[model samples]
Target: MNRHRLRLVTFDAFGTLFRMREHPALTYQRIAQAHGLKVVSEPDRLKASFQDAYRKQGASNPVFGRLSQGSRPWWKSVVRNTLIGSGCPKADVDGALDPVFAELFDLYAQAAPYEVYPEVVPVLETLRTTVCEDKVPNGMGKGTKFWMGVVSNSDDRTEAILQSLGLAKYFDFVLTAYHFGSEKPGRGIFDEARLLARNCKAEECLHLGDDLERDYNGPKLIGWNSVLIRRNNDHPVPAGVATASSLKAAFADD
Candidate 1:
């Protein structure tokens, strides 16, 4: 038994829980044909533009980042913005792309969301226990309702994606930064999560996530015991915080 007084556990979605795939290139040809754009026929160019805008904008704009999660921007939109910034004309840009938003949404629907790390289910299972005959997961102990939440930067579609992935049942409350209109490293979401956990002492709850700046720094600032799950640990270890090699170690014996 960990006996660590950890009543609630929180996680980050996207890179922390789920992985994203780029299948938008397949539909690029059709979108381009409809838009009368010949340059997008070059799948390589489309893929490059897609990835650039995707990663560059991630978590930088917070809300925009989350909504852009599953969607790839239109090649013309990408070109239009780049050209516009480079002093291209309004007519040149507007005529360069028609129905920009629709094209972006169509591109969004083509990609797939899957597990980030294969060990997630097993690790969560080891960390939590299923109660009663229906096998509903109640974290760690028997009879006591454990609090599980997600603090993420994601589109409004995040909940649907989680449900579609069959991961909706494992959590009690899920909070996305998109809904909150903020992102991690800001501490609003983390502060709210602590209040939601009903645990006044930071020592009583633990937070785990892949982003260090938002996941680690934000919670740690308010005295919550936090762990950096490989992706986030850029800072020198903070006082009173702990580290784990993996979540598997959190429930190894069970």
Candidate 2:
């Protein structure tokens, strides 16, 4: 892959740039206690409940609703169902659900739950302004320039959340599941992103993400260069796919 010809650098928001500092289930437990709702507080049990509820909620709601429709009812349902699944009585789940959801929502709205990777800022800065020394004739415009973008599977408040984390300024635009009506691993979102980066061809763009299927397969299927950033050393690197241990490593010239 020639960096000189690249015109766009797209990234997956979570894990690639930033990630939740703490599991949300732990926060749910504290919120429930504050609301005077007696519930299971075990980390394992709460995590299981949270996962189940989240999966169920996501499955049932094909499209993530927008903030105009109360900012994703599926999320609220996930919170409510999680409480019930965690041994909170149904009545308590109902009574305390609003406050619990509000607290969690606000918590997420700020940067309290997230931590940006050490190399994120510098990598983004480079990608945002990097320009090729030579011009290419593939309809990629003169002097080969690159723009920074985010194609993330997140809620409508993604821009606001990125702002709170102080990472929004680096992105030219954000394409989110809430706005696209489809999540990653789906062609529609990537298609939308391609249209957004009109100046770049599929091969001239690069997308970096943590999930192999969403970040690698999705973009590869659409002909975009994809890199998998494995922050954790545990997962096996997928065969024939570019893998990086950090954002810095991903963009480092070979």
Q: Rate the local accuracy (lDDT) of all candidates.
A: 0.58, 0.81
Locate the minimum summed-lDDT window of 10 residues in model 2.
Answer: 63-72
| Candidate No. with top TM-score | 2
**Candidate 2 per-residue C-alpha lDDT over 109-135 given as tens digits, one digit per residue, 9 for 90 to 100:** 788889999999987777766776555
- Candidate 1: minimum summed lDDT over ten consecutive residues — where? 130-139
lDDT of 1 by residue, 1-254 (tens): 24234566788877666666544443544454466544433456656655665555553543654444432342344435433333335574467455644665544433343544666777666445633122222333445545677888665666776776667677877887767767786778777776776643465556777666777777878777666666344556656545544555544553
The candidate maximizing lDDT is 2
Give the Cα-based TM-score of candidate 1 against the true structure.
0.64
In candidate 2, stretches whose alpha carbon ends up further than 4 angstroms from where it belongs are 66-70, 136-144
